[model samples]
Target: MDGLFTYNPAMVKAALGTHMVTGYAEDTFITIEEISQGTTSKTGCDGETVRSVDPNTRFSVKLTLQMGSPTHKYLLNRYNRDKKDGNGSFPILINDLTGKEKFSAINAWVTKLPTNTKGKEGQNKEWTLETGQADFQIE
Candidate 1:
């Protein structure tokens, strides 16, 4: 069961790049230019307004799991400081569905080998997968 929780690295990269700018905001989209270990580029939208949030933003990959579960979910989070800078840390909030579960002792941590890519128009898109677990459990 522990090994069953593994993630597809390519999928993680693509999903992170896609969501880097758009976030969880409604009707928002991100135009990803590049994605690498600690860097990303994207066009961000705040409603009808579009602006660039690039270069200054750093992305880190993470895996989250409930204390007693064998499954884990991958997360891509942004920050203003490098991991070595030791100046900033931010929580990556679970989306609306998981937030409602109120799971106990869920933990999140960094993932290895985060990838990078150059921006390609029309290539930016979101991909989500349904886990085998019940909707309320960490999947």
Candidate 2:
């Protein structure tokens, strides 16, 4: 479909920073890395290559604290749209930080945005942190 879509890693990072559930702040300097995308195909009757309807994008971010607490890690994912639907939304997943471990548990948190809101001409739109659970285990 022909629609505007944007993914600001900065904004995603900011969202994670403001997330108190992680018990960390933006100053913590979390490192985010992209993992992989569509690289496989389904079984086909012919040798023709089949494209994935929704390509996947994965991210891994690490957060270390000065305290003796374990380091925190998060995994984020974004899937591309297969078909254009006015009611379709983007999906976001989050993994909380635990002990010195490098990655959080899978499916720690997940949410979706049905539609994006528009702001005044030059002003930026604000994102609301009104979903998912919030708690800190890394001290």
Candidate 3:
């Protein structure tokens, strides 16, 4: 059965590649923007009231971090260095906190990490898949 459920925002956990952001250890991370598990879409025919089974799943994460943090520097360097590498992809893990779960994109890259920010805000880091889904599990 499907029904609405309540979740705790503080339990949202994330990691980049092999880094853990759950604060369970020395290496931890956080996001200021809203985080989602992902989204799905299906192919459709023109003028047809039905949808096909071509699923399009992409997980796009956007968050702001303090301008001068160590993470900010590392992500900035990584983004600027590999923006043009066609084969570059960054693995990410996002846990909803009920259990330990992980997923890596089929193909992924850092899309945005601006150097500027709002009057008193921080920088944003966002990643979106190029040609695959973001729901693959890690064992």
Instruction: Judge candidate 3 at residue 36 and give its lDDT.
Output: 41
Task: List where candidate 1 sits over 4 angstroms from the true fold.
Answer: 1-80, 97-99, 102-114, 125-139
TM-score per candidate: 0.24, 0.24, 0.53
Going through the candidates in the order shown, the clash numbers are 6, 0, 0
Predicted model with the maximum lDDT: 3
Please, what are the lDDT tens digits per residue for candidate 3 over residues 83-114? Answer: 66544465666666643445555445567655
Per-residue alpha-carbon lDDT of candidate 1 for residues 1-139, written as tens digits (9 for 90 to 100): 5644443222221122223212221232212221323333445475454444443222322232222221212232222232446432233332323223211112223333224323542222232221111112334
**Least accurate stretch of 10 residues (summed lDDT) in model 2?**
123-132
Per-model CA lDDT versus the true structure: 0.27, 0.32, 0.49
As a TM-score, model 3 comes out at 0.53
Where model 3 places Cα greater than 4 Å from the true spot, the runs are 1-7, 21-48, 84-88, 98-106, 118-131, 136-139
Q: What lDDT is reached at residue 91 by model 3?
A: 67
Please identify which of the two predictions, 1 or 3, would achieve the higher lDDT against the true structure.
Answer: 3
- Model 2: residues >4 Å from true position, as ranges? 1-28, 37-54, 68-139
